[model samples]
Target: MSSTTSNIKFNRRDFLRTSSLAGGGLLIGFNLFTACKPNAKPPVDLADLNYKDFNAFIKIAKNGAVTIFSPNPEIGQGVKTSMPMIIAEELDVAWDNVYVQQGDLDTENYTRQVAGGSQSIRFGWDALRQTGATAKQMLLNAAAAKWGVDVNELSVSEGIISNKAGETLGYGDVVEEAALLEVPGEVTLKDPKDYKIIGTDRKNVDIDKITTGKPLFGIDYKTEGMVYASVLRPPAFGQELESYDASDAKAVPGVIDVIEIGDKAKKLLAGEKVNWTAQLSPSAKVVVIAENTWAAMEGKKAVKAQWKFASPPESTEFHDKKLTELLDGKEFTTLRKDGDVQKAFAQADKVIERTYESPFLPHNCMEPMNFFAHVTDEKIHLVGPVQTPEDAANTVAELLGRDVADIHLEMTRMGGGFGRRLYGDFVYEAAEIADTLRKPVKMVSSREDDMTTGVYRPAIKYRIKAAIKNGELTGYYLKEAAINGNMYGLIPNFFPAGAVENYQVDVAKYDSNITTGAWRAPYTNFLAYAEQSFFDELAEEMGADKVQLRLDLLEKVKGTTDERIQYSPERMQGVIKKVVEKSGWGKQPEGTYQGFVAYYCHNTHVAEVADVQLENGVPVVKKVTCVVDCGIVVNPLGALNQIEGGIIDGIGHSMYGNYAFKEGMPEAKNYDRYRLIRMKEAPKVETYFMENELSPTGLGEPTLPPAGGAVANAIKAATGKRVYKQPFIQYDEIWKVAEKPVLG
Candidate 1:
């Protein structure tokens, strides 16, 4: 939980000058203070806003309208609205009085422009509120100076300022003067109890626009002179473009051009200044540009390209033998170590051992990948749904031989990001194609391309061993092996890390040519499924209550003076007991079986009870009672929606089974082959958050990690079977039944 992280400071920047409205109005160009970059520093003196290098534009119209620009990317995580709410709330403005606008990536002015890590709210929770409070204080200062009264004697409500003497001033009346006021070194924040908008149920700023199809997503983005383009990538991971004949592609009716994208094109533009070929790229592929999306698709299909397959030295195959060798290996890099684990296991009355595995899960975001870029001779303007636009812009600059100033990255709403958008390969490819064609280009990816050409979630295997002596847990050891990238690096010691007296966590890894990126909860998404399921098995082994055993471990952690425990044991116990009580843990409906699991991730503690029933051979989740404590919930409705979505997302993956790879290529290329939770299979999810004054954490990812285990344990309760691997739809196979469970 501890490492080198720069102290975050607010730095804001505006992409465009504050465009004035028709009537007399104030275009407030507030400076962004600290950058979002890790090494960025806070101002030496806090009293002045002029010292920082970021910008956020807020406008107040003569008609008393206010628009606050949101500085982070919105990838359907509800950040486009939730972030502005903190500002509006602290400003004491009516919910209806404020307008929300998504802003561009300004690294000098913003930190964490990307939306992964569930940090949209966590990243700027305080600075955003302070922004609103600062505005309010400035407005108050302006009104007081105009009225010849002390600021303390004046008060404001819903953008209206008043004095005891009955003088009144609208926010619009003083916005001009307020803009001139200096940002104070300090400002007073309202008490959590007095918050008018923080906990209130307000619609998303773009709800109406989204529901009516009036608002635009990245895939829906368009320009007057934009051309459509699609890339033809190699079928598998270890293949690159060798040669291609574009004659058939160019012969298509609306085909504009066939662009070859490779080391040659990149080196020609970037020269030796940048490692252009090593940067973000969809793949080394050929681009088919056309007048329409249909033409681009047809033209791409007609383009026949030969590929050079990677030799054994470059290829990675985890599905077969390599995984077994890595998992069964003894040598490892010790990440966390405590008391002697060997002695505890040797002396224990009982020793439990199990291995759990998860396959490479493609993001399979609802919207296929796309980015719109216009790289002309002068400046480069790239915009679309990228989770990390700032990084994308940097990559584009390296590829196009452009300056950061010349490159402008705008984030549009995304249908679903999951974690795929974090890599700007799509954006880079779009920029490359546009730069080559000398025109605006919208790069589109078919579902097949999206699934096939993914930095998929790394396939991981966990070997867990626990020692129990005289019916009491003693020691634990976990060796997690992952193919491809970093695992348990950011979060070490893990959950049971501090829960046990003698504990150790070791990591083993193997090289992979297949790319990998963060999926939902990443490690926790699979680790929790294994660890918590082991606890249930342990509960049965020790003759302890399933829910009581978790509470006991947390209670032990609470009493322990362990310095490594970063999470609060009280918080863990709070959610566990709350879920147990809420879900009627001891009394289940006659025909329904139940499962329990709890986990802490992304700084949120979540406990879930999945109530399920066996329909034929398939396990159907009937209802899920979820209790979460993510500090304070930002938006109850939105948080509930997130919890519901995550639980169902996990259930869908668990029941349908996730991605499978063969010959280093994903077998499930699209939804037809891939599986997702259908609406008919969705269980009713009841969600609740504990009352707390802690700054808001995140919820979108916490529920998902525990969902798979909860369902797996429930399947154990329904049919005394242990399903180790996820997509437990294969459970019936444990009995070697004539018919497998029908997932559909």
Candidate 2:
């Protein structure tokens, strides 16, 4: 086990799997993986799972079946499949017979089991591989003892051990004895060349269940005597629940109870040393409990409540307007600075300055936020689709004045997280309602409720000023503006920041009551669009190919002795060259204009090219070619799928995604106003990975950063205009002019 996981107190529940491991079958648990930080949400699973001693991983059955328990929640990133592939490959097990199951929330047994930030494969690599290798050695010892022969004289293949004379025993036949042997702290792992299941394309563990209409998502979860619960929220931010009239809701048919969640939470935490890090209660809400989902929803529609909203500061009418005005305000912080930027600009032949903006976006998970809770006087049992089970359990414990040990958390295969479920506010609400009703309850957020009261992707505005001297880049200056002016999961001095001679970066803030958090790649989500698109424009000014310009920059940065430089310029150049060659950078078919972009994050590099055309004045992206270098591809098929999906998600969100606030309320109520890329709008995407022996990184997000820029640059190519803002809404007019949008 790693030193960090040792901090968690291991309880018996975590070690319970071991009992089954050494019993009828062999179950081997290895070190827990604690990859997530203490307080990160939004694309990082911060679910404070509080289970103990679950550090073990693999189990072998007497029937020659192998079961692998994946501790991390599967949010459609393929962790459940890829993590086990690592173990099976090292263990030399038959891939066909390996079975995978989702492990319960056991922070002590599993470190940082949340599934955000695409950290699953990267963090679990060493631990999971050791698990398989260690178990294999134990089994070898058992076989050697039975045969009274040296372990080295025995050869194993696909769960069977045999001597040169053909004396053999199945792995299952010796697994019982192996379980009693002491675990080796060190074991030999398989060479990548020897891997048969890893690099090969493998099916998802839940593909059969998913394709055949099995219950896998939180919405599909159910329990006996569990009534459906729903809530009605306050109208805007900074509002409080004064009083509620539940008579009408309770009168509705099938409605069991209409309770004020604030009152319930108050009672649950009454007079106790309870201080949950976050606000456990909703902004201002009322809960409806009923026999079923339909009844709960109907009852919620019938409910009404009075709200007392304290007046907020600032003359806030429209978000874009107020934010734009505040961009020039004095409240700003410097994040990075370099050589004399003003001198470089003064010496430049030409200078260009522009600002780019991206609006708040809802996660819009396919399954709306939902969780099931059964809160009793003694214990709390929670099960649902949450990104951060550990974080959630800890928060619930604080909210209810209970010990972390008394709260049990479990996660289902998520419909989608995209960082929304990380907060587990919905779980707190469910637990509170269940405690009040004294029955098991499942809480479901309506699309309106989920969208309106969400911790949205913070609306951000970025301004860049560049100085080009004699056809070469000279200086770069950037000032980012947001609700808090905080950059999330993205480094201000990453990539080109160190590559430039004179560079400076600053941040400006305009505080607001609306909550904001990470979405996808966070700052990189928009940073790539702004920086890469700007680079494309610069490439045109220098009469150079966009792809070659980036390569040239990487070539220059490689020899520089800048103390701030972090990435390997060689790796960056490698990905760029491979993508250019595969995409035929300047050699696309007639009328197929192509846009190209490259970015590095989470220790993975990706370059993308979107081939597009003008279809009825709207840009129709026909195809996208992508090249990835994420280190040794654990599951080739899975990695490719993630890259493809990320490209589509990036394009979809950048082009059609936008949200706004008017009078402290969300203007985009649901998908009807907010947009997502549909199948007809999706481009045919192709993915290819670089062959390397380096350790693997997660692929859930690397491809996303560059996609929006590729599509935008492609749009620029086809229409000869730049989109300075997101949600390229007006198809005809967007290409006619490039100007800062007028804030209403």
Q: Pick the candidate with the highest lDDT.
A: 2
> How does residue 155 of candidate 2 score in lDDT?
87
What is the clash count for each candidate, in the order shown? 16, 21
lDDT of 2 by residue, 3-115 (tens): 12112222333323463544488767744432122332332222232322225478788876898888888999999999889888878888888888899987665766766
Each model's TM-score, in the order given?
0.91, 0.91
lDDT of each: 0.76, 0.77
User: How well is each residue in 27-121 modelled by candidate 1, as lDDT tens digits?
Assistant: 65444333234454432111111122334556677667988888777776677778778878877888888888888877755555666767667
The stretch of ten residues in a row with the least summed lDDT in candidate 2 is 1-10
Q: After superposition, how far is residue 252 of candidate 1 from its true place, in Å?
A: 1.9
